[model samples]
Target chain A: MDLPLAIQCEGVSKRYPHFHLQNVDLSFEQGTVMGLVGPNGAGKSTLMRMVMGLIGPDSGSIRVLGHAMPHDQIAAKRHIGFVAEDMRLYESETIAFHMDFVRSIFDSWDDDYAQVLLRRLDLNEKQKVKGLSHGQRVKATLVLALARRPSLLVFDEPTTGLDPAVRKEVLDEMMNALADETRSILFSSHNTLDVEQISDYITFIYGGRVVESSNKEDFLDGWRRLRLTNPHNRPLPDLPNIKEAQQSGQIWTVTVNQYDDALPAQFTQAGLTVTAVERLTLEEIFLSIVLSAKANIQMKVAS
Target chain B: MSTSIVPQLVGKDLRLLSRIILTFVVVSLIFIAILAAIWDHVPAVVQGNFGFILLIGPAGTCGIVMLMKTNVLEKEKSTQAFIMSLPVTVKEFTRAKLWVNLPVFGLFWAAISAVAFYFAFARGLFPLGGVPFVTMVFLGGFVAYTCILAVSLVSQNLGMTVLCIALFEMATSGYLWAIAFLNPISQHIWGAVAVWNPTAVGIVAAQLLVAVSVIVVTLLVQNTKRDFI
Candidate 1:
């Protein structure tokens, strides 16, 4: 039997006068966390918004928790906890008012957990929302989202403006929300450290398209940077999966994806001594993917 | 449909609605009392002149309430974000907008107008012939309020709302001025009894029809919105 998916999007596209999300396909399996890593205006937020049923795609289909988006969104929302920087709580209302308001709508809201979060987050229930700082506001939204214990949590840049201490606490709370094995999370962020610390799977998106998506371990293992000494100055081999190459005198640094143990033999056969092989961090991988994609686009435009 | 969705949204806007409603009621009552006092003491010529002033309360009330609803509640970005994030459809959101403005402002307008019209005709403060003018006042307010409410709901854009108000004001001023001087309505203004000429009745009927049509059109347009955010 095929594994169940919390979210699935195929050939989904949206168009704006200045930007377009083209032919995007992505999926998040049940009981897994998928980190959407991208820079600003990379369509990460747009994709997350589509999955939350906040925006409708111009073409293609999206299913969230097995319900068609923006059509069965009401039913899907019952199981989805969405948090974004643009999403806000009522300013004049107190945290208590919001808690009651959200609790009124969701039958799954847990008062005990809500109380725990309020205490843990150090939020005053009687305090008005506008009085809270930026970090506190984000935490308040998180408290509201998590207390309901949604099956799927979708966060769009939840930690963008938060301080370091608050960011860690929020990330911890997210981890706590995921203690249940059946729960799944799909968060979009430009912060790779947060993604590296929390996500089970990683996806890189750039220029309104997904560059790569895979399990975290597979991504970490598949991309390697090899430092080699090319004394002969022989022409570099046209190796497959070579993302980028840099040279200084006789030393050459080559970055390759889908790296394997057999790659070293190929380097030796080419008469190049492999001095060192270094694993690429998530941030390095993200930069390489974006740069490579940008270079490819530039090359295509030039040609 | 989420059974509690509309009410929940209504509750979100209830505080602002309550404030506007209270202010309108208190201010209208005071204005009506002052008008009644001036009617008792002032000369008949002055009474005839200020009788129309009694309507300023309800008309002003309607305009104020419409302004508050559009400017403070629905059109604000934070409030819109909060509302659109809820597990409610655009239809439900539109219904909530209608619920907040129409009934609250409608009831306030009706209550104040009834009291003002009662003093004007029933209490014999002004000639019953002026009934058509008072009715025109109420109908004009209803049309303007409905147009503003409809535009705010459908577009939720402040610029469109301002444009609608400006156009409604210009059109209302022209219509009122034309009726007061033109053939049909001006002929019956100072008569002994109130008269409902075809033109007067027709204008009133058109106002009612346009009011209801705008509301219906707003709902229909909101239903077709694919992107709630």
Candidate 2:
């Protein structure tokens, strides 16, 4: 039996005065985590907001846990636990007040899990939100969301402003939440290291469009930075999947997205000697994809 | 459209605002007590005019503070996003705000109106003729509040909301002056008995109509809104 999708967004488009997110298709299966990595103004937050039904698409269909969007948003939201970097609790209220508020609304709220998160996160329940530090506030929001036992958790830059130790604690808690194997998460972050560590699948979004999305292993396996030597300084041949190329005298460094065992032979057949082949990290790969996409758009505009 | 979540959200807001509401209520009752103690010492006109201002002050301030806490500050502080994250639609959120805020203001308004009514007609402090004018003034404050609430909901912009409040306050002052000096409604102010003249009745009717219309239009606009941050 196939796992049902936790979220499905097809032909999603949203147009603002200065930005347009166009023709996007995205989905992730239940029981998995998908990391959405993007640069600033890359529409990651916009997409997440749409997924949470905080905003509607200009034209597209979105389904969250089998409920249609904006129409059945109330039903859809009951199962979604969303936390964004800018989301805040009532400043005058305490953590316990918020926890009680959430508990009253959600029948699935787990008090035991809430206490566990409070202990693990080192959050004081009686502390007012205004008195807590930034990291504490984020943890409080996370605890509020997590303790609800939501089937789908959507986090937008949840770890953006945390210290290293707290980030690890948050990531670990998120990992622990998935032990049931029926829960899913879609989190967007600029921290590629966190994404690489926790994501089962990775997606790269740039300039309001998805550039690349696949399993983490496939992403890790497919991209390579090759250092080639040209003794006679002959012009390089047109190569497939060359995301970027930089030259210095006889050395040419080429980045390719479709790396395989046969790529070195293809370079040799073109009269170039492969000096070194380096595996690209997710950060490097993400930068290459974004730079390449930007170059493509610039080239099209120039033409 | 989760009717169930609406009450939950309303309950949350009430809990959060309970202290502020209590503070305002206590302050209002204190103002009334002060007026009652000074009722015989001041001249009748001074007591009637100045005392009315003192009586309405706390309730009006309460409405403004409640509006700011519930609507303006939430957006300014980004807590609206947290509220939106709950299992609620924009409609349900609006409904909760309306349900929580309007009644709190209504209760304050009604309480102040009751005390003013007791002093004016029951205890014979002011001429019974002043009852219509007092009712119009109280109703005028309610209309102003509803208008401000509508603007806050529909615009969701701090600048616009502030502007709406300022404009309504100015309009209210002007309306008060016109009714006191220029309108035929003033004829009944010093009469021996309360007179329900056409002008007095018309002004009251119009105030109610505006208050109801503003709220209805606000809900309709919220229903069509596609994006709420």
Candidate 3:
């Protein structure tokens, strides 16, 4: 099987009473990080849960690391480490107890690696799970998941409770885990910057559907905001792949997905001044994609 | 990247069930010591009397661990990206629970049976000698195991389950005199349950029935689509 893709999901559909997760097709190759970004209730968590075999999709085929879930999820999970935003550890137990308990069960557990992570994360061994601060709790979860040294690590909103400083450290540790090259990560987050910072590929989910998925650099570079003046009073052609456009006074600011050096010349021949053409950041691209999806939905409703 | 594939579902299940078994052992040993202390003075057969407590150990512990994140995919981070990134199947995941459940019950059953055997010999209470009473006690332990599995597998509230055990006895009037007077109106398991030689094989039947029920529920859970509301 050439060790099938780490995640290969197709035509995944899940319907809710008020919201429907539509045809969520996504894939992540081995030895790469894929960041999943979506607004709340956009089905980011739902997708992650399905991958973990925590939940099943309404209609879909999912193969994670060559195992057809969740029939094989048990066997497959052995090599996988998962940490959620609000993972509940035994509140009454000391971190040491949990460490010992987790260590005893998995043959892959590295006691030496665990010790190093604990110190690096600055967590005290004697600290009780309940007594740990929210950031400390996240760090503790990371410590447990990381030291196990699984081939794949799945983090769901891992940085949710951490402050900026803690978040950066956690991200650095995550990056450190991926330094081995064979290890892969799939994380869901609202923080686009985090998504942009570490993700080799990015997927945008909005209102239970994936609006966009592409390489991070390609996504940012693909989007262009060009300034144009409409001198002929001619409406722009309804071009396919033109995600969105905005008008300010006589200037028409158009957002195009596949931007090129030729864009300014086309507007110049139309007797409109081509003032500026600028590349958009991932955050701006994310907003445009979401807004465009909303517009598509609204337009569909109106007609 | 060790050559061996990871099996964390079963692995985690083991860790989870270990604490549960530990708890049961701790609680059971305390009761056994108490039973050993009271064996001579009490008229009741120690083997027959302690069946219910023994039954609840394995399934109850597994249930508590499961309940810890019962809502993991339900109420918490059902992260689409993260969960999908693993290397496992849903059925394999659910099977890990059963793998953990059976052994836990097996351990509990083994422990209590040993205790029951010891207590039966130490105490003089007998059903024409304690062999038949021992058989009956084993049967009750089986029923308790099955009942614990059935209730824990399906139940959402741990407190209510424990309460149900107590309420059920109260409702059926399970005491000896109540059994003597109300035998005509008594229920199936309840009527003969408290007796010296309660039907051990019959309780085994109940256990099988519960085991089947759990399998059926698990299949339903397995095939059903997870929307994660």
lDDT (0 to 1) per candidate: 0.83, 0.89, 0.68
Between candidates 1 and 2, the one scoring higher on TM-score is: 2
Candidate 3 lDDT by residue in tens digits, B1-229: 3222135545654654455657766777676666666655655634456544543454345444443333132124332223233443444444554566656666666666666655544443432243433444454444444444444434424565566555544543343334333333233333323343345344446546765775677646655644322
Model-by-model DockQ, in order: 0.57, 0.79, 0.24
lDDT of 1 by residue, B1-229 (tens): 3454778777767764565667667777777788777777887666656765665655565555555564344546555655556677888888887887788777777877787777767877667788887788777877888877777667667777778878887988787887788677887877788899888898888889989998899889988887766
How would you encode candidate 1's per-residue C-alpha lDDT over A247-301 as one tens digit per residue? 9999999999999999978888999999999999999999899899999999999
Tens digit per residue, CA lDDT, model 2, B60-177: 8888888788888888899999889887888888888899889989988998899889977787876888888989888998999999988877777789988988999999989888
- iRMS values for every prediction: 2.0, 1.2, 6.6
Please report how far candidate 2 places residue A68 from its true position, in Å.
1.0
Mark the regions of model 3 whose C-alpha exceeds 4 Å error after superposition. A1-3, A230-234, B1-145, B155-229
Candidate 2 ranges beyond 4 A from true positions: A1-3, B1-3, B181-184
Instruction: Choose the strongest candidate by TM-score.
Output: 2
Choose 1 or 3, whichever is better by TM-score.
1
Rank by lDDT, highest first. 2, 1, 3
Ten residues in sequence with the least summed lDDT for candidate 2 chain A: A232-241
